[model samples]
Target: MSTPHVVVVMGVAGTGKTTIGPLLAARLGVPYAEGDDFHPPANIAKMSAGTPLDDSDRWPWLDAIGGWAHGRAGLGGVVSSSALKRSYRDRLRAAAPDVVFVHLSGDRALIEDRMAHRQGHFMPTALLDSQFATLQPLEADEAGVAVGVDGTPEEIAERAVEALAALPEPAL
Candidate 1:
């Protein structure tokens, strides 16, 4: 459990990865990248049209993101993504063993609320349920912590920082 140099705030859509990632990055004093920005045009279009992406649609994008992760977090960087499946996390881990996932767990109501209230996002509110259905909560076997979203964004970010701080430092 080395302190994660490259940390990913991961979960299904509306789990606050975008909102909390930057805060976590600030806490860790590392630069951050939003996983959505890495999505290829087709994936973005599908999601914008309220279609949930399948594995085939995701693999290439995931690979590209992994390559980016390899370079930035090879040294260490913070990233935010809806890393909903074990395979997705594996792609990231393949890039860097030091990569750690921060799983944000919240109930459907709260997540839907966030998605509905979210503004200026390509992902549509209609896709929320599908995202939840597709989400495979990170297993304990995965190397990281599962954080409960039971408080303010500040509280969650601070809790994540504290947990990360307690882990052993990266081997780098």
Candidate 2:
């Protein structure tokens, strides 16, 4: 049997990457990894202090997540990442070339409102602007789909699955 594709549930913070990732993984019958868990303590500390991470602060974190994705390459998995920049996504793709993304797209107002209501997340609502500024939506050459984050987690997951299923199978 052929191996399944690993899906990267990506978006800016407060887009429900954490909520939808597990559901998407369940739908795909794959394990789920929380990208934030891979961050170094320093990175977490910086964010918790309301400081935005620069590229230097993110490289190691991205590499850690990439390593996990690399390990699950053939096994299939769902991982969450606020893969805001194209360069960040490129780093992930370098580790697992076949990994596809499910970008959770939504309006700034909606995301900020959700962020404000969330509790205990290290990423502050203040960083939402930076995230939006950094985001580079998937390009035509990228193998992924964008799903609206305007509904319940279950509904969004279903839409993600449908969109992913509709993608043309990647060339081996």
Candidate 3:
């Protein structure tokens, strides 16, 4: 694609979206945005307390991230979001029509281990099951690819880049 593609690093909690997002953005020479930074304090508090966010708590937050993706459309950027539901991805696509998702997927055991070792994140290991349950993998018609999180952050980002390269260009 001649225009820059908005690449959203999406997955369940603890899948390393934040870790790999900036790397992928750097590799593609685009701006980077952190999805967590866009969350409202209430959402953070809820997640920190081990409560899974309901759709009511998420719509506004998702809109904010979608707005960011909209702002970066055509110019490219990487943003990390849990994007655990198909409807959530659809919301983002509405804002940024050309957005492409890179889903970092992994087994529950591996994800839980990663969450346990994580520090200072609002999302706790207790909420991982909810995140997984909420997640809907990219559908065949979606403009995205699912990359396994079986490697180091760098390796995963590299794999994402390769996957993106292999895909047919998103419609302009």
Runs of candidate 3 with Cα error greater than 4 angstroms are: none
Give the TM-scores of the predictions, in the order they appear: 0.91, 0.96, 0.97
Who is ahead in TM-score, 1 or 3? Answer: 3
By descending lDDT, how would the candidates be arranged? 2, 3, 1
54-123 per-residue lDDT for model 2 (tens digits)? 9999999889889999999788999999888889999999988988999999999999999999998999
What is the lDDT for 133 in model 1?
78
Model 1, runs deviating above 4 Å: 1-4, 168-172
Q: Which number leads on lDDT?
A: 2
RMSD of each: 2.2, 1.6, 1.1
Question: Which of 1 and 2 is the better model by lDDT?
Answer: 2
Q: What is the TM-score ranking, best to worst?
A: 3, 2, 1
Error of model 2, residue 97, in angstroms: 0.6
